[model samples]
Target: MAELSAPTGREPGLRAVPRPDGTMPRALVIGATGYLGGRLVPRLLAAGYAVRVLARAPERVRAFQWGDDVEVVEGAAAEAAAVRRAVADVDVVYYLVHSMAAGTGFEEADRRAAQTVADAAAAAGVGRIVYLGGLHPDDVPLSPHLRSRVEVGQILLDSGVPTLVLQAGVVIGSGSASFEMVRHLTDVLPYMPAPRWVRNRIQPIAVRDVLHYLLGAARVDPAVNRAVDIGGPDVLRYGQMMNGYAVVAGLRQRAIAALPVLTPRLASHWVNLVTPIPRSIARPLVESLQNDCVVKDDDVDALIPPPAAGLTPYRRAVALALGRVEADDVETSWRDAELSGVPSDPLPSDPDWAGRAVFTDARSARTPAPPDRLWAVVEGIGGENGWYSSPVLWALRGWMDRIVGGVGLARGRRSRRRLAVGDALDFWRVEAVEPGRLLRLRAEMKVPGLAWLELRVAPEGTGARYDQRAVFFPQGLAGRLYWLAVLPFHGFIFRGMANRITAAAARAS
Candidate 1:
């Protein structure tokens, strides 16, 4: 796709058609599949706006509880026809869609999409265009994610359609990707060794406040066409956010150390292993927060009134979000008896691994047992089954992980004999499960790098070959050192693991 045409500094004369005061304002929400959009739609409906959603996949939008109540446009923001259809006859066109999660060339993708929406909104004469953008300081170099958001905001503002861009800091709430990252990491790890940027201050706004601000943006004065900063009351470091969650969850105080070795880019991948968020979205989310993300001005205050109860504090937001997901027990409920919405609502899929430092250890053992027989033993490896090779070594490793605030082996497999993708098995998450053939577990244990263990059974001769491989994509020098330090144990631990697993399968038969 071609790049967005240069924005003319002179604002164009095109403007959204004004609406009558008592008339129900029509709102067209782009990117309805996103966590923010999904939450925003319900609140918008509850607030009595005539809601419409434009989704690349309309089915995903229809999956929400409030799905049936809104108009659905079937197409992506990148498609001009879709954007035009979505913007038609709408009072407010909300540009909630972004392409950071779309992988390579996300910047261009966002620019193109934002440009498409901006032009469409302008042509349709929408009343106001509201965009939720990243909060970043104007002085420093911005992360790719933040820079793209800033550029998108500018594109919209230059479109001549009255636009109000709400630049929000780290958003804290259930189903929020950033909050989920902190939630899972803090829940699994007691001690976190994070990047130095963890010390960076961030003003995290609750989803409730974000929705409140967005609801207000719908009625914002047409004279407002500038980016406004929005954030919660408290400004705390990234590490403090995690501990605040611990406090709300009634967990022991978490120890957070800003380590120079761990880079936020790799850390993003590590956090992705545990959190249910899509792979593509996690990196940008993590990188964006590497720098301070607090609101710089009270620009939002002038445009939108604060929530009647005031903006939610960081810890209180965490507490409220925690109430949503606390082991099925009745704690926090956004709705009635049944939880209509899950906090782990994931975005579309994207392969996370691209260019990275990779280290691998491949080992295989031939077993007299058949592939199906061996697969049974492989699938039941974690939780109660335990790693076949070494109890002492695995136990020590689990302890080491737990000591550093990792998930450890305490969270066993959900089912003793069955394995499915995304299931948490001990300290490893089931990345892929091809029944009777292969099982790939991504390491959730606190390590210096992103790691994965693959166990697959292949037919060989009259028996089966149980191939085992461990892959590690180290972050920096520390990751390499971490690998070298543990190289000796690979033979004793992995080789025996393969051998013992095959033997167990044979015995099972």
Candidate 2:
């Protein structure tokens, strides 16, 4: 029950540590920027642990509000230097980094990463290493994905670091791929001819509960170091899960017939053809599903106990997943084909905009100043600044929105310099604001479907490059027509807007 020593200088009680009554210990969470890692870091901090995190993209790590609260070390876990720096002076280490996103040879990459973590943890004199892996009964012939998962855990265990391996099935959460898959399948497909794996009995865990066990595992005595199977309340067949998801999503219960002829690879391809999720992610996921993934061990219950309340039933988890989709609360998705790096040469951009009989006129300008200076001018747009283009046209657009009861340009910024969540900027609501790098605004004005105006300023040469991207999400046939109708004048409007902003910034400078 030893407590982690607290670092000082900054805040009063914020910097104070609990008396090391041998109660709490320090934890270092690798992959702290990932979905599970993101959730776990805050939980550990709340549990009174001086948590440190090692992230490949430290900027992304710093962007999270938790970055200020925890020590952020920027580097990959495979890098010995970064691992040594991260693992030093930590009681327990959480190895959560995986190369699943690295395309092929994911198994080999995972093995090397596990070894790196184990070696680094041992060198730094870490007490325990807690690893979260996928669930698959050891008796069954494991798929490559599940095999890699178990092998990684084995490597960690063999590292001579007292390791607690938690084997979990599909995690149901907002950002989780498994949950999103269930949601998408149910939402997009009313009827499905599924593969034989549809009969596979899988016990899916909620992300909240997975996090609970992980945090609990970190605090458990180093003496308890063994792989434990973890799952949710229900052990339902994959087909049943689909039915449950459809019900929760307010969709008609779809009929799924298991076909023996449909192989996992073929099933994966089928999924890619229908759902937004790509084959690269879908194939591995579908392949893993061929094996029954129900929990075999009940040891985790003794350690962490059942999650308190609001434990999402399979139905409720599906409901939440669908709810997230409706609310546009997506954090990341396998549908993000851009980052996948799939070969196609001139990789097409967001198809939501392209192939449409619409107009998209984009304009960029260069300014002789830091990105911050350029962004300052861009941010000061709309309202009193009058959009830096045609004041009369901006007013007319506002008038049109007013006729339709939309927010229009009436909603101005809360403050000139400071911006917070949900703040308004003329006809747009600030969707996201990344200080000097990006400022994205969602148009609240009446549009065809969804519309956004994003201004990105990146430092280039001696100055900054200002790029303005105007995105329009059309609804149906009428939306397409509206876009096409306005296509001709977009060139003039967008170009004028971009140049004026640059000119305004130049004058201010």
Candidate 3:
């Protein structure tokens, strides 16, 4: 891969991806909306890369916190005109796109996409190309997913441009398909059956370390134009990984059975039933476990130095992923209590908040009441005062949460008419409050993801405008499904709450 010197005036004692001319490197990311691509773009920007993204739907890219930070070139990678436009004048290309979710003939689709990107990058004379692939044994027959990845990396390497293909296995992070699989399987079933591959060894790496190598790949020696193995320390069998997660999450050790009869397809179906991951994606991920996935050589280390803190161990990565829920950092992820700005102001406010799929619902109404009357109603919400909506729906949700061992609505608020940031209001925590303006509550109920409710009031035309928003960041597939199931109720819950609050305020005026 081509080497670029670090930008001038960099923080001392820190290595920056280098560009010889001391100018910012322009990078084109093909899968800028995926988990890896979403995380990589901001880091590339921090590392001094002028980023440009290629996507079929520009709105998806615009949804990212860094959406406005980079130039968006709209088009599918399969389209030559689109890929050509994205690659032009770009220094490096990050091929993080994979269509395993497309299912059935996803391999061919991946191949065509790779060929399109490779040709486009070569034609543009892109400085370097980086692609993340799976780590598998050399002698055995690779799974269809792994084979497709290998083929894609080879295509990029042979495109007449220097390419650095970093192969990793079982990335452990929140919302990651693999990590979510491990999480949900442990959380749902105390004893998991079947899947003889559970005994297979795996060298799972943390998402942070994966991103680390990706950033470092920018400075790999120009002659280094081949795939390298990247993994974390402490390799263990798949079952042991689950037990390790159990330890970190304060759960009992799980009983995992590796029965020979459980084929990959059957195992995937089982995983689909238990975890948030769907069968389509779970099949390939499960099939990958058919063989051990340990890194064979230290080729990656020879090119890019490991993180100074060293690779994150398996248990440590699990703890990092679970720490958010344990500490209620999900509430802190909102970035502030005032409910100012958009939902994704800094994209992810913290590393802990990364990898989640965010969903939101918002509504507004105008009331004849002044801002103070509206604020009074907003602040006096929850507790015995009720939510100014369907009490039956709220109570039913609360009862369900209680059944799941969550802190149910019985907690109520500290006061009937006032609140502070740390007060517990029923199944919610008062996160932030702006007197006569806004009140934001973080949901403490047991759900598959993090949720928040925001109430706002502003004076307008001798009246007041009341706005309400419900936001959620789903953990994984389960979380997505949970949101979908409740979406129909949102019109009744949040919309009714907004309207009722406005009506109450108008009557009080």
Candidate 4:
């Protein structure tokens, strides 16, 4: 494995320790493509540890800014052979894999994966195993998600390998499942009718603090080999969290009313409709909110001192998360992790005659610029840059989308000058991006049908041609009517958009 060069400046609260071989300790992060794991690997590298990542799909991590800095092993944690290969010559193994988003049987899958990893680490003679688990009170009846986390931590500890389990609740950061729920809940609803679980008091930690504790675990005394609960300083209810988020976002005061009739299932559906998070992932998370997740003990502070900057305040954490969102600097999102058990087929893969009538408003324009320049114009569309067509019409559409619990244009594009698969462009999710060739976006707006807006740029003659296609697969008669109703605006909106994009490309060229 290629060694990670030591960073010039060391991260606070992380103590550097050289190995017996006069080299840095090698740490292997399983599930490195995950939100926490993705962020943690870079910290380990900066702290002078030779970092390696084990991911089921290595391509997912390839886009990460630190992708080339660390070694990557392609394999799932469930595979013993893959686990053993990843554990080889590693001092610390971070078992960050979990199956909460996988729906049913996740607990069993997590248990099996944990056992495989722990056993492999023991066989490899790895010094320590660090695992991040959910924080829940031991006295209360834990939700399936929280219970599975605790169970996995036990399996790791029982492997007879010294394991440090850092248990946390509601990680407040951009792209986190918990924080996204809070963010969307506050952003969408001025008056929130929440479930009783929203009243349950819990502690929330910043992702930065979570990373700090994870890095601190590497240098922690080997004797401390048990679960340690970690959380931000404040203890607040889920409702308060939403309100706090509102305050941090500088939005109008949100009034949340707790409703006794709202069940976790119902709340999960509500979260699904309002937030970018799907019901499969949101259901498990909503169920866990019933139990208070505050840190009951402060023993972890002694084992690993708090960072010099100290723990981030709840509101400050929300601000930081929002700032990251606004700046389009979110490193990794919960969506980056694959969601299993939820069966889904790509639009292109679906059967052509799947009882859905497909509609297309395809248009092409010859641009007086090369494919690269035209592609640049394509990538720069949406958000503050607008649609290059009718700004008023786009705003009206966005407002209508927001009224129906859609993401709307406010979510914006993650980058002003680039496009990536899974990045949000207004109410559309980037489905595919091929640099100078193609860009396809799947609409997240509430509509009667599935919609995609695709832009393709190709070298044509002395310059390039831009092909713009607005495709919609209608559900039924309502879908067809919806398409027909919007058909009048197509001539003005789409044609103008194509022309403007061409002009923009020409101007840039």
TM-score of each: 0.63, 0.67, 0.67, 0.80
Model 1 lDDT tens row, 1-509: 11111111111211122356666778899866565675667666655678899876554455455678999989878899988888888988888877555556878988999988888888888878999988898788888878888999999999999999898888877546677778778888878878888889999988778877777787777888898899999999988888888888889988988888877667765665554433355667777877777788787777777765688898888877666554322111111111111112222122444555688899988989888898888888877678987789998987676554445675555455666554567777666667778787777666777788888889999889988889887878999999999999999899889889989989988
List lDDT for all candidates, in order: 0.73, 0.70, 0.76, 0.82
Off by over 4 Å in 2: 1-24, 324-433, 436-454, 457-509
Please give the RMSD of candidate 3 to the true structure: 11.4
* CA displacement after TM-score superposition, residue 467 of candidate 4 (Å): 4.7
C-alpha positional error of residue 364 in candidate 1 after TM-score superposition, expressed in Å? 32
Candidate 2, lDDT over the whole model: 0.70
- Write down the RMSD of all candidates, one decimal each: 12.3, 12.6, 11.4, 5.4
Rank by TM-score, highest first. 4, 3, 2, 1
lDDT for each residue of candidate 2 in 461-488, tens digit (9 for 90 to 100): 9888999988765779877887888676
Task: Give candidate 3 regions above 4 Å deviation.
Answer: 1-18, 325-509
On TM-score, the stronger of 2 and 4 is 4
**What TM-score does candidate 4 reach?**
0.80
Q: Could you give candidate 3's per-residue lDDT for residues 1-509 as a string of tens digits?
A: 11211211122212345467887778889887776776677777766778999987675566455788999998887898999999998888899887555556878888899999999889998989999988989988988888998999999999988999999999986446688788878888898885878888999998778888888887777777999999999899999999999999889999887799998887876765555354556778898899988999997877888777689999988987676444432211111111111122212343555665688898999998889998999989986789888899998997776554444565454356767554557777666777899787777677877788888889999999998878888878999999999999988888889999999988888
Pitting candidate 2 against candidate 3, the one with the higher lDDT is 3
The most accurate candidate by TM-score is 4
Q: Candidate 4 vs. truth: CA RMSD?
A: 5.4
Give me the candidate number with maximum lDDT: 4
